[model samples]
Target: MTMLDRRALLTKAAWAALAAPAALGGCASPAPLRHDPFRLGVASGDPLPDGMVLWTRLMGAPAAGADAAPLPGAEPIAVRWEVAEDAHFRRIAQRGVATALPELAHSVHVEVRGLAPGRWYHYRFLLGDAVSPPARTRTAPAPHELPGHLRLVHASCQRWEHGHYAAWRHVCAERPDLVVFLGDYVYEYPSPPDATGLARTHTLPLARTLADWRERYALHKSDPLLQAAHACAPWLVTWDDHEVQNDYAGTHGRGEPGDFLQLRAAAWQAFYEHMPLRAGTLAASGFGQLQLYRRQPWGRLAHLHVLDTRQWRDLQACRAPDGPARAVRPSACPELLQPGRTLLGTPQERWLREGLALDANSQPVRFSVLAQQTLFAPRHYPSGVQSTDSWDGYPAARTRLLQDIADIAPRNTVLLGGDIHQNYVCNVETQVAGRTRVVASEFCGTSVTSRSGTTQDKVDAIRRLNPHVLLARCEERGYCVSDVTPQRWTATLRAVRDPLDATSDAWDLARFVVEDGRPGPQPA
Candidate 1:
């Protein structure tokens, strides 16, 4: 049988299974009683070789000020979670109870463990007599196993008002081993004033309070395509600026002079409540200061180092009128020359340096993929308008990071980034000891729904400026899928026809492969 035939068969089977009856209780139902509804469905994320975090929320009837008020007569409720080897739950591997507290907005995150590696498992939550839909998750590949292949989809920037998430449907169809959400999962700003000709129109303004953020998340979660994608695989996620506010720097709000510390605290609390993060991993700083820089290994094929760039970085400088008018010009801005500016902050930088060192010694880890947000290589505006945001604003810090990569000299270093609503492949460059050194290759995924003006023009300009950049595509919107093997790591940039359309087709716009010991991406 052909590969296309197998894919068609699998798609048919998946849709058929979705229509099948869900697990039902054998016993008779009692008198109807008030029970918290499970509206958003169950999800699992942050998978490790031995464990993963499960998530769910208790949806109650809409109340006056449901967003803020404690649920009437609220009490701590026990949420029992179980992980089983099979979908039938006959052989349970892990089980535990977590408290659903009103303080946490009735969300539950249970981290389950004591499971075997490189295996698929099913998990669910039990609240009182009701059970949630089972969620499927897989553990990281075992060390030294050298699995034949690993597939993962990377996406970001899902602005609710921009358009529909039809791209998510294609991602779900792919059935990747994992999903890495780079960031901008939610935009905190109010709907743009000129939102005409957009995909999905916004119904409200910027998110200010916790309830506002919650409602925004609820709206996005209600999308069936996104939910289907989440249900398909365990995800690893980190936040960018929009998760709190646009252009927010450190503890400061965007241009607004107020108690930023308080705002940051609120944003952090709401973020933790809505995400599928392990309870213990939640931060107490109230400022969303959790350390998310961590590494995961997939046998000997790859090691992923996920980083948080927005939380600790310095404020992005405004573009200088007298300097570069185009954002894509590398020499247009002086802030890019700042001596001490940082993207990962001090602690995260230290952690990454240490982690890269560790990967250097580990034999099983071949490719060190920095799964992060923002374009690692310098990308300026084509019109000669310098961007105050992105790595270009902090050239010294980017230089430091590239230098570190050169020092560690992993077998192959690749930076996977998302944001900017465009896809790009660039060769990362920096200067060390007065010597120009190229460190790694970077692949930036385009937006899942967000819009950009120069999606097509930027691609052409990027290629013109950097020959090392193998490909660029700005006009299209879609996600990227990576297939990793012992010999090579291949990336396919998939683009969708139109996000506003109910049905959109996805096709591979470009393909590149990084062979073992190679430092750059080559067209496949």
Candidate 2:
């Protein structure tokens, strides 16, 4: 060949090499492993109609780490992964290899596509001699296709020291289409070494460094119950304060004395390392930022808008930036009423407002869901105080969001959230022409296993103060399973009999339904 022709051929070869480990139906060379490397178990998340991300981490001996972070200077390994139509792998739909790099803590995220829509599929990871667990995941329906039904279990705040993972055990039995994690996947605080009567101990130092954060995620992911829930379905995840530090507002962290930005970067990178998040999300968020907000369309039945309330919000008002989380009277903190204060920063706010206007069909969705992190209503407390860590602290922002829903999706919006350790079913109202109106329904599911410190009297006082609240209960710890149909949306507030019990079962504490074209939730 001529020199010019040779140079052109070399350029094409370089491009192909850059796109290495070709996708489905392509070729890959997988490797052999000495022992099983699935101790942390398998997980899948962020499913699309044609594809989703499948994840697993290569690990050393359990004694070394959970899917231990790779040793210094470890080389990247080619790990093979497969997507099948059946659990037994008889019908292999797609198979490919992904590199587990030391820089990413040896974790592999394989984006598998070209699968059928609205169908269940089984997936696993392979390292030649050893095989990982077979996990189940499903994709969403086609954009214009109206789904027959969709069931999702939303949960949050499971602290290791607070209780056992009985809530997740119950979730596995529910067999839902999707699992929505509204944040606090792992707590940053360590359990008191001298404390007794604890269900479990974090057994590590307070997570502040990169290694510390990795170790923290390892400890949490090792739980069989948590693993089972993950293996059950694809999850939609976002972070709350506990994932990094308590009550961290944007770059401000509990008013602590340290390089907070450096600490946040480590915690967030570790979060990316462990979560089955899209790799593009990390880069898109830019340095020192991690994007966690997106929209998930459930056919024409519902539009799920997952939001991030911690990463870009204004600093907490009134309290010392390093102060504890508490309910402060509005009069004491005038900044709470500032119009510019935000919980879901402006960019996210605009994105959410636009999505609620119309779906792909150019029609209002049957159910417009704000699958977010905190209570959205005006929740007044006993002494005219509201939580500084929740939406109650950003009144103007809350008003704007509520008004946006009123003007856009209006009667079909459902607000699903968590953060406060209580079960609440309430109405989100709007002021229309000097009259009070209920525009959207709200259900705040209590924690998966976190403890609630509020007393019955205090809860009673809160109920008396806010008449719009239909139900408020705080004794039990569990999650909410939302079943959506074209006619109505139903939420079952299920509570674990005992979060500390390994074999505990959950019972439906209460059920509420919002009929289509109606704006409020009623006992079902």
Which candidate comes out best when scored by TM-score? Answer: 2
TM-score of each: 0.87, 0.92
* Candidate 1 structure quality by residue, lDDT tens digits, 408-464: 887788899987898888777667788766678888999998886664655687678
Residues 308-339, candidate 2: write the lDDT tens digits: 99998988888764676667788888888899
Error of 1 at 451 (Å): 0.4
Poorly placed runs, candidate 1 (over 4 Å): 1-36, 62-73, 192-195, 255-258, 318-335, 380-384, 431-438
What local distance difference test score does each model get? 0.73, 0.82
Candidate 1's TM-score: 0.87
